[model samples]
Target: MTAKFASLSCAAIIVAATHAFHPSALPSSSRRPATTTTTTTRLPMSFMADSSDYKADKSDFGDGADEDPDAAPAPLRGEVDMADVPVTEEIPVPMSRNNVGNRFLAVVLDGSFNKDDAKDAWEMHGDRIALTERHVMWARKQNLYNETFNLESRADVLWSHQLLSSDLQRAVGHAMCIDSPTIEDCREAISRDPIVRSLLGVDPETGMCDVSPVPLYRWRQIRDHTLRIDDGRDGLPNMVMAFDRPEAISDGLREEVSNDHLEYLIRSERVIAAGPLHVATPDKTDPRSIAIGTLLFFNAVDREDAIEFVENDPAARAGLYETMTVHRFNSLDVTGKFVSENLYFPGQNTYQMKEAMEHWGYPVDDLQTKWLNW
Candidate 1:
């Protein structure tokens, strides 16, 4: 069953439909910088909408509406095959949940960790993985787990946040978003996890790990859009980017820039997930509650390709974001169709969790028993 589930998960395809954003009603600004690259040029019609909507915009096809016979075909409209699928009012598209409330992106870095040096740390590492999975299971029960993933290239651990260390020789960590009412509650959650505390490397006697939660007020993902998780982009590395907005940028300018940004992302078709990062639940009527930045998870040919993609965005060019960092990341399909269809079992008290841990080669005796108790 484990092997079969693994095989199926690897072959899963995720598809997301493009969202249409009509021109913003707010005032506009030409803050978007000019680009020399043809790929970055704005198209005649916004890619954020379906290609069928722009059939009249013949400019998209060269000067061959009725004159030239050699012009190439118009762009293919993105569509999903739902022939055999049942139709219902609530079709249960995965990852469409509007998980709201106070959430923090937590990062856990292990400085002494090296994937190659796993001999001595293997037992401890397994314990950590087992414990973290247990934590995720608990979070799932409490409706707190949003997403959990580790750095694909570096650490074996997982959590989400960015921390800079100058003297660090090597570091591996994971990141995740946890729903907690307050920062103190977030810290307590981290503290209760023994493995996380050890990973923080705080001195046992007097030292303490102080977690300053990076509050994510709101997260917006296109509901109907599905992405093929197994799209043949094996050569490309997945990327995780966090764009930080400078306070100086006003809501009007950011909204104007988003029009171009969204179009570029849709046209690129590399986006796995892309959305605005709000500091708090935003009121449509309140300009002050507007999103502060953007979070993009996508695929790129390489590091350079990822950098270029973000750099070419209208928001980046307009200096809307104060800092935008892109890093190569490996994504786990947690909270997505991959999890629900493969590893997860509805209700509880199943051996699903045990099977998952065993498949990952983690010692599951205690962890599995603990999970069953919940």
Candidate 2:
């Protein structure tokens, strides 16, 4: 949060971040980061675990997160009533497998605590609103697509490695460990994050009793495991915007428009990552083509520019894409760096006698290693 943050050693950052958000483990009970609310009073979403009937559940996509989304939604798992919830378990709580049993509770407690109109869907859909705003701000601060870069030709290397380096990736990982509410060591990891503690509805210096804030703990579990993605300016794609091609679109039209647009986005260097989804199954004759909309990942500042580029695309104008969807994307493997290795697939699917994946644009040019500190 300050110049000191950047100077902090990895271990030091973790310690500070942890101590800042998790005040419950502090030496004295009064030092917790919470308001002096009656601990016994039932808070929002604290309902009877059982005998709490609800309308018949609607079907949802099952293959969530790591798997296919078209699959039927996994059956609801675990009890969500504040009373039945357990925060510190030896086995550790999971994200997808973990579900808030009470639909009402799920609706009321989705990682956000608005002082006014508590039941409003403000934080639902994965804190979509807050994250979106943060993303735009991150991009702006990073100075993406600034005047100097915009004036320069697309061919030149305009992006700076200052924020996109491997060291930053490790820094983000450390930040994530600190941010993660579900991480096994999070009790020690979070101490008093000023921003996060406020959101948890607790005093930044005086945390509430461990047992009383079940709602906060429950929501904390959810928030901790939500995702590890950062805003695009940090070189971590917080959102992935996908466009799908309609079945009726001809190859000629797709080639005439989308292909060139794809090149423009790739060369413009405004995006953290972009790719076209193709049949990854056993059926693809060619991995490059399957007629799907492109996926572009950018921070909030680039939102308008990204949308404009997509909306003005020849294919989009021609009504080739049947549907468009923008959803949050967190890279579990990439960490926070944009290393050359991840820029493209490692091996080729060359089925013609010999298939091999090759490098994209000659490995990142004398890449500087943080470990080496060259």
Q: What TM-score do all the candidates reach, one by one?
A: 0.45, 0.27
With candidate 1 superimposed using the best TM-score fit, by how many Å does residue 292's alpha carbon deviate from the native? 2.0
Lowest summed lDDT window (length 10), candidate 2: 100-109
Alpha-carbon RMSD of each model: 17.4, 30.0
Whole-model Cα lDDT of every candidate shown, in order: 0.43, 0.30
Could you give candidate 1's per-residue lDDT for residues 1-374 as a string of tens digits?
00000111111121111111111111112112322334465556555365555433456547554765677545434432345345535322223132334444444433233234443434544545555555444333333222332111111112232222111111123445655444455555555444465544565687665443212234444443743333325334343434444453445667777778778777777776667755443243346545656666676655445566777877777767654544444333333112322112223343675576456433344322232212
Best by TM-score: 1
Relative to the unseen true structure, what is the C-alpha lDDT of residue 93 in candidate 2, on a scale of 0 to 100? 17
Candidate 1 lowest-lDDT run of ten: 1-10
Q: Model 1 TM-score?
A: 0.45
Off by over 4 Å in 2: 1-240, 245-251, 286-289, 299-302, 327-374
Residue-level lDDT tens digits of model 2 in 222-296: 122122233465323422223334443445555666566655555544455444443222223434335444444
